[model samples]
Target: MQRPNYPSGKDLLSADAVSRFDLDDIMERAERHLREEEMEKAGHALPEPPAPRRRPKVIATLFDQRSTRTRLGFQAAAARLGHQSIDAYDTDRNRIGQTTGESIEDHIHTVELYSDLLVVRSHMEDLPYRVGRLSYLPVINAGNGADEHPSQALVDIFAIRQMRGPIETLGIALSSDTRARFAISFVKMLKLSPPKRFTLCCLPDAPLNPAMREAMTVLANLGTAIGIVHDIRQTLDHDVLSIQMQDMSKFAHAALGNEAVDKEKESEPFTLTARKILDARSDTLILNPLPRFSELDTSCDSLPNAGYFRQVQLSVPMRMAILERMLLGIPWTGQADSFPPSSGG
Candidate 1:
């Protein structure tokens, strides 16, 4: 059989190229292949698939920002696929941001000689585009200053797909850290159908971040409804996926306010309790981006439909497919051809 002719990283330079990178491309085609043949084999189930194990080159992680899951997840994904990850933290370390302030272009050009890809996390929204203009290697915006975190969105979708059946009209409630809010925001924006509706349930002080707002723009274009409410009850009315984002800064208030706890005392509601979900509907699925706080009640764990922990477990396989594609350079575009025509398009 002929091997898949995947699009090179250079193909992403055009906005029209999105059809080439759409998640459906991964879900229908790449994911099937990875699950069937290419997933990493170890103590898990299958070893690495028959496809080439090692990446054609190295990836320089130029993280100008901080992250635990994004950074570590990428590193873990790269290693699982037999790729090398070079951590370039400071200009003192990589000399890109310091020492005469070498242009990002120059730094990218310099690194391209040794690396096959660049994973960048910047504070500026347009920085990825500017750097992409200069780099010859594939560029992944790890978290481009809240404008977008496509990879996280992809993983979140992957988790949802595993836990629930379909998402065309799926609704999600975000009760997470500001960082994770961007991922939910992007999903609302870029989704072809977008979520029917989404709710923002955070303390008044911990509102959605700037990038989250950008994602909301995408949802707005789709005419998808969005509500920014101080409470979760407003959102539980829908077929909900609760994304509990844990930020240490917000943990202090976890014990205060809300109906689950007595207002006279310092206690918060059990956001993910079975009782809470049962009040809404039994099928309500729980989701968390990981590193959780006390907001999610432990009682939900015994319920058959409880899915947050399963959401975390699903990340391994979803990431396995992503690593196979990025490192092996799988062309996710095949779905446009592989599946029969659908009326939705």
Candidate 2:
């Protein structure tokens, strides 16, 4: 069968799609938007006003999983861009996945007709890929099942840049589940602006995740000094440390009643606390994709190093930048025609 002729607009399906040039452009746009917002907040009139669009664009969000940040972030971004948004999929109102429902093809075709862009978040890893193949409308993979949350990674990088400084000069550490979608995307995206030193603080005895291992190898090849340590303390000396709960698969399986929750406290060794930072007298800028669990202790909230809340705030402009760029039909220059098997997630 012949492949459908996709539109010139790009789909941001993976961090690997973004190039250093793309990153620079997006970051510049985001910084400009943030400055404009700050100026407006200070009651300063702009020297040049935003040109109104001939017709307001519509952004359709097809999220099969629960979300608080990604959904609102895009909606806010669309509104800021003088566009509209619609929740394209609602299990309560839509029948796309029901026995009596329309097929995904029919649903996507209908959505593409109504919207200019499609933002997808699903527990199914392949949903965004399937949608990208099925529809000509540009698709943004909000989050896929333990696969890649590329947009969130962009937000994270933006936060780090804004809070710390240039990406290439910093020593960065990630304390997370090796299989985490965000972690995978984070490490992959780092290749565009390789850090001075990159560290992975994860389980000691467990073998590295294939996807993560591949991403780290790319960074290593790029001359990033990569280290793997069992304890979070080993990473405390780094300029920035991004952290999340470990072994999400175990928690997910437990939640689904597939198996008993492991009584073993694996996270203790990896958890970050204010006490540790204070005792070490470290100045590491701490970041977390929120809805944080026990992995990030609340005691760290008052510390100057805690940047997660600010990280959340920075996501708005970054999201706006993404929508703005994609709407212009600019494709990511670095995207491969086909991703390698090891980079699937």
Candidate 3:
């Protein structure tokens, strides 16, 4: 396939990398893919698959953390696109993390030669950036230590747009850890299409993550009516509420095996329940990136407000769109012209 020329780089390391135009393009592609699937499922005739690539593209996943959805979603998306994925990092079998392991430079050099694109998830905040600098292949940051999950943000925006309506007309609330990677990416990506009202429901005592603060500042400057509230109830009037656990550091540490998992209950003020939704008489759509903790009550599962499961369903086509665009050499032009260096937060 012939490649398209775009000034933006091939790597999607941060939500900052996607421009409004890039986001629209991606969403259009995802919607098209989704429509075709729905049509096929309805027993409608569809065009035949294109001829296979002589050298099918390889997507290399280097996840140094545990996952369920993101991992399988990308692998499945690749298969649908006639591509394959390789687990590039294996702590037990690979020399990368051994006592006398090869340097990251050496490891990436070898991995880049074998793969056409790299999707990275790491506990280290800068690992993806480091890999992006080292590899010629397109790099997608699956998730990074309290940094950002840009793709998840894309999935989320796509979900909201699909389920609710245009984002610009919506009142969106995020009830999550201020440092959560997905939250950071979500807010950052929102700068592309600022919502009418953006409210944050977080712990009253905790300071906002610097990365999140900066991203929100961008949205505020874009004319989004930004508000910060301590209770989830305060956000119930919004059209959508994207939620997650409050303290991500505890989970991050547990994922790194540095400590036992924290099983502490979510704070009452932050938790969202069906009763609360009913009592408030609000019809806010609820969204959670799963492996959900107590913050999202199961009581809300059957409620009309629940949209996380549908969010997961929408992720497949989004992933397919991302892979298809990058594989076609279309660069993301969503980044600001005067982009500053990431502090690795």
Tell me the tens digit of each residue's lDDT in model 3 across 164-277: 999999999999998999999999999888999999998889999998899889889999999999999999999999999988778753454344575679999999999999
Ordered from best to worst TM-score, the candidate numbers read 3, 2, 1
- Looking at model 3, the pairs that clash are 18-334, 19-334
Q: Number of backbone collisions per candidate, in order?
A: 9, 0, 2
What overall lDDT goes with each candidate model?
A: 0.57, 0.88, 0.89
User: Which lDDT tens digits does candidate 2 get at residues 259-318?
Assistant: 345543446789898999999999999999876778888999999999999998899999
lDDT of 3 at 5: 41
Better of 1 and 2 by lDDT: 2
Per-residue lDDT value at 32 in model 1: 61
Lowest lDDT 10-residue stretch of candidate 1: 336-345
> What is the overall TM-score of model 2 with all chains considered together?
0.92
Q: TM-score: which is higher, 1 or 3?
A: 3
Candidate 1 per-residue lDDT, tens place, 1-345, comes to 332333445322222223424567656543564464333333345543346754445767877765677777777666655677888556335555565566666676677678777778776556666656555456666665544566665666666666665666677666655555344434543455467777666666765666567666767677768777665556566665565633433332232113242222112532566777778665767676655556666787887776766665555555555555555555334221222122230
